[model samples]
Target: MDYIGHIKLVNGQVPSESLLLDEANIAASRRVDLHVQTHDDPVLKLCLWDQAASEFWKKFRASGGTARVVLVTTLNPKRYGVLSLSSMTPSRVFLDGDIQETRDYLGWLSLNQDVANRLNADVVVKPEPATLGELFSYMKRASAKVAWFECTAAIDNVVHGSKWYYIGCGDCHPKATKGPTTLLCRKCGKSEVVGVAQYLAKLSVYDHNDQAFFVLLGDAGEELTGKKAAELVESYYEANDGVGDDDIVPVPQVLIDTIGQTRTFIVKISTHNLDGKTQTLTVTKVLPLEAPAPKVKSGDEVDVELCNEREDLADESVKRAADGVGSEDAKRARCG
Candidate 1:
């Protein structure tokens, strides 16, 4: 049997608000053998979402087809919490954290060494545009007998594949490399890629009353490094008791240099408003060591005496003319 590349049918716009469900139903009717699979899956799989998911399952059951649903999304701990609330049963849900997690997830599938082998289908979910290149590369290198699917908001990004089918809006087809614009899909005109950016923009709004402050790190080092810096600053603040903000506290250069050596230690203090604006204060201080004292003689006392008082001690006549005291040589001669 000849190998067939995986097919990706994207619903670029939300099915709840748009005619995506009606369009998907039409496509499904035409290609009854359609299977869904994620990029990480070794085989094609199905995706379940909104109202069409129920209808698709019903049709599959009626046709004696096995229900294979793949759930791909962010690996939030809360996702499991929400799953407990939902009654939907998927063949298996592959959990991935990020692009890095996708690598491990695919590895397990490719090896056929784990639970992934038992799943009816696998689907990769919530892929970012940056990782698309890596995903395509992995697909090309895989030796497993599997198919792939892409759930992208931008359907024009899909590569051509043997089993590929376009599903969604008429305009949702892949963009021509270059030429006079053609509305018809080069492979098939039944479905095409569409623009859904406008609708997505509306859902970006949030309530201002329940705003949360988030500090985004830009070119900053590791969490440990930041924590160390914060600890050092906290120590300084605590040791000084109540130093004013404007006070110039001398910090040891050795400590400052040691902290600076850590590439990840950028100190950023910030406050956020419900309006989505942030005020940030950066802490930059250099501490230096104290100056050393000059060396001096032991038990030496430096006294400043008047020049006039020292003149009498220096003159020989002033010493001999003194009434009470005489020179030691004169006293010995008079006694002999």
Candidate 2:
């Protein structure tokens, strides 16, 4: 039977093949255990003997062990402790060299972190484009298809995660009660107000195949929402003079607009083992996606846009830093 699969693991040749006299028989003596994944099985083992093993090894090395794509033609299904694939004398193996399926498999392998990390670093190749479903599959395993892979996804929805900020006693407690001129910290039993900002955002992003969740930190959230945490709180206060403990604040309008927009992002994917039996993929890092430009335009519009974006970011960074320290004082002044 012929099978199209991606090589997951490759073992060293069996001993005594170099001692054979006949060329064909000597070739048959060389054997390698290959762990491959076919369309039917998520993982399957194949034993390549003699000539097939020798030729496959050369191609695997040439691909720097990253060329995981392969097509095994002419193999027998046999029981060796369990069901496995055995190579025949006439079996032929093709690497990523000329087969389209092999090329597609290479892209698929890029999404598997474990497979990608085990590959030789000298390969220095980028993964092929993949859908959200493919990315999730790669992450579901113990590792990723490739180290430091990127994905392009559309914002399916925005999830409200942590509190925007805590308003409390100016010095004793971050969350406090606001009076006419002074703040009261019930926990600290003091009267002074200070505001501390906490920004944690979670976004559900997807491509055609499926969806996954990503976490965004303060800076990333601010960039996406176009408003600082302090600003969001201030806006809330302006609309309603008093906020109760149970009052729910709405998300910033800017952030709401991000739903359905496409962006590219660098992802750090991992899996966590639970109780030695179950594992789950942890997908993180939500930031603006960046890719190489196809060609430089003759005009300065591209340059201007880049410069403006950078300048805005720089300005926001400085503003947020200042707000972090002075926001409490500003709030006190406004209330006083």
Candidate 3:
């Protein structure tokens, strides 16, 4: 179970980007990333858990950062949006001259230095933490179509009157609009679409640095509340039998229960944020609240001036979302 490849980038050199959390919100072990096939293969994210990640860095640093070629033993293959390798408990690392295998790999790298020297930040590095104020600065810059960041913030309140769920295309999950006798999925260009309920809640969240609104959409909402929007909507109709199926259900108790809790959010900035169309950072992933998470706790009164400018925009977006008539990015039938 050995993986040998050219080391493209090594993270954890700084304080902000050091930690990596899995979808379940648990801290993972160490990792060292690489690409194979003479560095022509797609980038592979090597995630090392526990001490594995730290240990790799320790070895890399000891090599004076001159070691580009690497070989590691015992990697557990994993898939999370992309292919990755997780170092197992017995996993170990080897630098350029650590052993015969690594020496041979170094020989290959020496001959293919041109390929080994190429760097793709997008492929090698994970997103770093950004503050609410910092995200605002990116509005003026032409950045990536979508960018992600880690933010620790407290949920101020669930935005009432905002549509808590969206009616999405049953197949592709894009928001579906009503047609004469069927649902219309413009994204999929399907005239006759089946509809399904999906989570799209809005929250007034704040960090010590700034306060902004977070759109809790899809699985992120499910992660926070431990309930699915579909099931919640279904249970509501079941209790209120006389009500129509299309009625808007208020934010459920499970969601509201999160109002006073502080948690870490993996925030996604879309074209809307980059182009100054909106300031709302969509929550794609939610992390559990713990000691090392957000500095501000739930229901804390943040600085009034920090939120003044962003408030109007957030309210307008919420209104548009409540009516199911916002920008097509309402795949914020996303907060993707």
Q: Which of the numbered candidates is closest to the native, going by highest TM-score? A: 3
In candidate 2, where is summed lDDT lowest over 10 consecutive residues? 327-336
lDDT of 3: 0.65
Candidates sorted by lDDT, best first:
3, 2, 1
lDDT of 1 by residue, 1-336 (tens): 111112233232211222223446745543222333444444332334444345443443443332223233321121210111111333222222224454454454456534433433222232122123332333344231122212111111111111011121234322212224423344334332331110000000012122111111211111312323233444556789889744533432222222212111111221211111221111111112223454454678544443110111111211112211211121011111
lDDT of 2 by residue, 1-336 (tens): 997776656652211223212335435668767766654344556888888888886676565555656788999985422356889999999987568777787677667656534544222123345566655565555423223345677776655533433443335423456688876666556655564543444466777777666544444556556666668866777888778745756656666667776766554332221112112122223344455455556875453232100111122232333233322221111111
TM-score of each: 0.18, 0.36, 0.52
Ranking of candidates on TM-score, top first = 3, 2, 1
lDDT of 1: 0.26
Best model number under lDDT:
3
Better of 1 and 2 by TM-score: 2
Candidate 2 lDDT (Cα, whole model)?
A: 0.53
> Candidate 3 lDDT, tens digit per residue, 1-336?
678887765552211133332323322423444443335666666666656656666666676665666677898875432346778888787777888888898888888867765654434334567777776675566534445677778777676654688777787776778998888987669999877877788787777878887787667888898788889998998899888766778778888777767788887776567667667767777875443333454578443322100111233343456334333231211121
* Candidate 2 off by > 4 Å: 1-131, 143-149, 160-195, 270-336
Evaluate residue 222 in candidate 2 and report its C-alpha lDDT on the 0 to 100 scale. 61
Error of 1 at 225 (Å): 4.6
What is the lDDT for 65 in model 2? 59
